[model samples]
Target: MATYDPFRDLERLASSFLETGRRGPREMPMDLYRAGDHYVLSTDLPGIDPGSVDIDVDGQLLTIRAERTLTTDDSAQWITRERTGGTFLRQLSLGQGLDTERITASYNNGVLNVTIPVSEKAKPRKIEITTQDGQQQIESTTA
Candidate 1:
């Protein structure tokens, strides 16, 4: 004979309720860092279709969106359906000095990588300083 656990059943019921309440879009986890003259932003989007991924920039705001769909078989019984199917969204406010026009993104291995290059006016360069003695010295400075 199989044993019946009321507590386990109650817990499962509560979990189901909570999961059903979360029908809205979820946020995509990401990591961002500055690399040389560019910024790299990587987001994790496992189980998401590459064709559903969309990236856009509006002014200084950058938005990323994707979707995951779960195919269900009505005749099959589900033991535990923990994986969720919904839209994934993330937005960021880019600071000044970034080359938004040259931004690029790629999706590979369930990861989305975005590269934002620094504008020419924001890059560091060597400036020639002329002294009163008519000698010129090179000084490294950031614009």
Candidate 2:
């Protein structure tokens, strides 16, 4: 019995040319979401050298680039090649409230993790309310 996996087949057929040792620019799949006072981004880039990863920030644009190489002997024969080796590029538009100066990135076990912290101005804060007697009191905390 065989189970069907269209996604797996689609992904392989999509970038099969890279298996032939052709270099190309590909999008690195990522997940970005807010966690507490910061945002976390995780992308998959398996079989890539850590030193080949390049991260840069230009204005409010964050760019990430990396390369994966497949080295083999000249007489090597590939019966079922599926892994891709090429340059992976991705860019993100940072919002005005996000802190761009304190961004950090790390790679471990084929996954790249990036942390984007929220700025002080964008953080939620509580404001004091004034009563009719000119007395300041706590209104409520803002989320």
Candidate 3:
């Protein structure tokens, strides 16, 4: 049993008209996770041209923008067209420990992958301990 909601269809119609090439467009779906010393973010932008994708970082904010357009022929009609083409936007707030300068992004198979490396200063390191009295020597490796 499926519920018929007229508002949902109206909302979808409004969104298709509202989204433009500018900002405030619909955002692409994504999944972010941490892997070892880096964080990986994967976003889905199906049927989008690779040249239309853009990634920019300012301060601690990372913004990803892309556009998809629906191409049609006048002869083809009388069918359902659910895939609305519009701009996609996504922003991420980076943390202090992230290495923003070396962030890399790649697009393949309609998916965009962004890798953010962790800063070296934030990684675990061994600290040496020593005695100031000059009579005792202590050597320890703490990871």
Which candidate leads in TM-score? Answer: 1
Candidates, ranked, TM-score: 1, 2, 3
Best by lDDT: 1
Tens digit per residue, CA lDDT, model 1, 1-143: 98999999999889888976898889988999999999999999999999999999999999999999999999999888888888889999999999999999999999999999999989887787788997986565655
lDDT, each prediction: 0.92, 0.88, 0.87
Candidate number that wins on lDDT, 2 or 3? 2
lDDT of 3 by residue, 11-36 (tens): 97776555533345788899999999
The stretch of ten residues in a row with the least summed lDDT in candidate 1 is 134-143
State the TM-score for model 1.
Answer: 0.83
* CA RMSD of all predictions: 3.4, 4.2, 3.6
**What is the per-residue lDDT of model 2 for residues 1-143, given as tens digits with 9 covering 90 to 100?**
99999998888766675455555688988998899999999999998999999999999999999998888778988777766667899998888998999999999999999999999999999888999999986687786
lDDT score of residue 108 within candidate 3: 95
Clash pairs detected, candidate 3: none
Model 3: weakest 10-residue lDDT segment is 15-24
